[model samples]
Target: MAGTETHYTLPRPTFDEAPKLLIVVAPYYKDIADDLIAGAKAEIEAAGATWEIVEVPGALEVPTAIRIADRTADFDGYVALGCVIRGETTHYETVCNDSSRALSTLGLAGLCIGNGILTVENRDQAVVRAAVDQQNKGGGAAAAALHLIALGRKWTGGEKQVGFRPVGA
Candidate 1:
């Protein structure tokens, strides 16, 4: 079973300056979301990073929230948390695909985002994944964001240079 499988987790990243992350959560599933938040917060703190959170209505809105924050806020990275359990209708696929795609698009555009939104066949799967002591997908997501932030800082040397510059000037 997946619960019994072992996976290698990357060591928590280190930084010269602590990163400030914005956690955007979709609290459609209150209990599940809370557990996810707990795990993510623990991971963020463990890495000597700081975080602030904002809630959106559902999974689909999580990416939009992150995009807005990236444009108008000063966060170094973002953690996206939510739960989407399959239901009787086709809404599950739409929510799952669109949200995942948007988050990926933003990531490709150089936004450091950890996507923790769970798309499960049932509530039981979500519960297991969200549990802080179990799968802890939330923590995994935070670690991903932190690693990306570390990489970004390393490559850019913490500088943002816009516009064209002469090569070997």
Candidate 2:
């Protein structure tokens, strides 16, 4: 049972400047979404970071929102929160695969993103995972974004100069 499983969690990363993050959530399941938001908010605050929240219509839109924010917003990182409970239709698979892929693509493009979307067998699983006191997938996602932000700051040797310059000084 997942409930009985134990896993090691990394200590929260510290930041010289408090990171600003945007939390994009799809509230298809209102209660679940609320729980997820709560967990994510708590985690962000605990790390001494600040965050803002935005709601999209569904899971498929979560990545798009993040991408737009990355381009036009001054956020240091992003946290994606949503719940996709498997249904009788194949739409579940589509949402799960497409959303995950899009988020991965954004991450590969250098956007610091934390994917907290819950793809589960049913609402029961989502409830358990989203609960702030339980798995807290939301918090886990926030933690992921924080870690990536730390790595980016650590390795960023200032902006690389593009194009050519004059020969020698």
Candidate 3:
């Protein structure tokens, strides 16, 4: 008699088990913003967790939203989505730099805000990057959030095996 083989599957942690997620998006580039939102929503829902979308006037306003959102509740993580294309003026640089800096501060404070903002040379590139493709940055941002959230949980001892010892116990 031939024996049947069974494949073992690893259980995927459900999103409901995590804290919560907030997605903050900049509406300056509405088209690209739409792309980022679409991708982000897919990932969030696929994880089986709740997600809220907040809009900012422009890239300059993303960090503030993140800060306020982070403080309001215990979010599992956050995703900051924006697209800034370089123009003939230096205004592009300023917005990109300032927003990046502000978000970095929040992350350092353990906000777990995913920096999915794209600073592209042109609208075409930004659109391509934001699309749901290999270059889809929205997914990348969500992944970062997931990783950070898990890291935080581990550091805070979310795992049950943290204090486990050998059979000698």
lDDT of each: 0.95, 0.95, 0.79
What does candidate 1's lDDT look like per residue over 1-169, in tens digits?
A: 8989999888899999999999999999999999999999999999999999999999999999998998898999999999999999999999999999999999999999999999999999999999999999899889999999999998886566789989996
Q: Where's the lowest-lDDT run of ten residues in candidate 1?
A: 153-162
Clashing residue pairs, candidate 2? none
lDDT of 3 by residue, 1-169 (tens): 1112333432334543745789999978888888888887777676676688899898889899888876786677898999999989999999999999998999987788778899989887887778886466786777677667766876774435557699977
Worst 10 residues of 2 by lDDT: 160-169
TM-score of candidate 1 on Cα atoms, chains taken together: 0.93
Q: After the best TM-score superposition of candidate 2, give how far the Cα of residue 129 lies from its true spot, in angstroms.
A: 0.6
When sorted by lDDT, best at the front, the candidate numbers are 2, 1, 3
Steric collisions counted per model? 0, 0, 1
Q: What's the lDDT for residue 76 in model 1?
A: 98
Candidate 2 per-residue lDDT, tens place, 1-169, comes to 9977999999999999999999999999999999999999999999999999999999999999998998898999999999999999999999999999999999998899999999999889999999999999999999999999999999898767779998993
Better of 1 and 3 by TM-score: 1
The lDDT leader among the candidates is 2
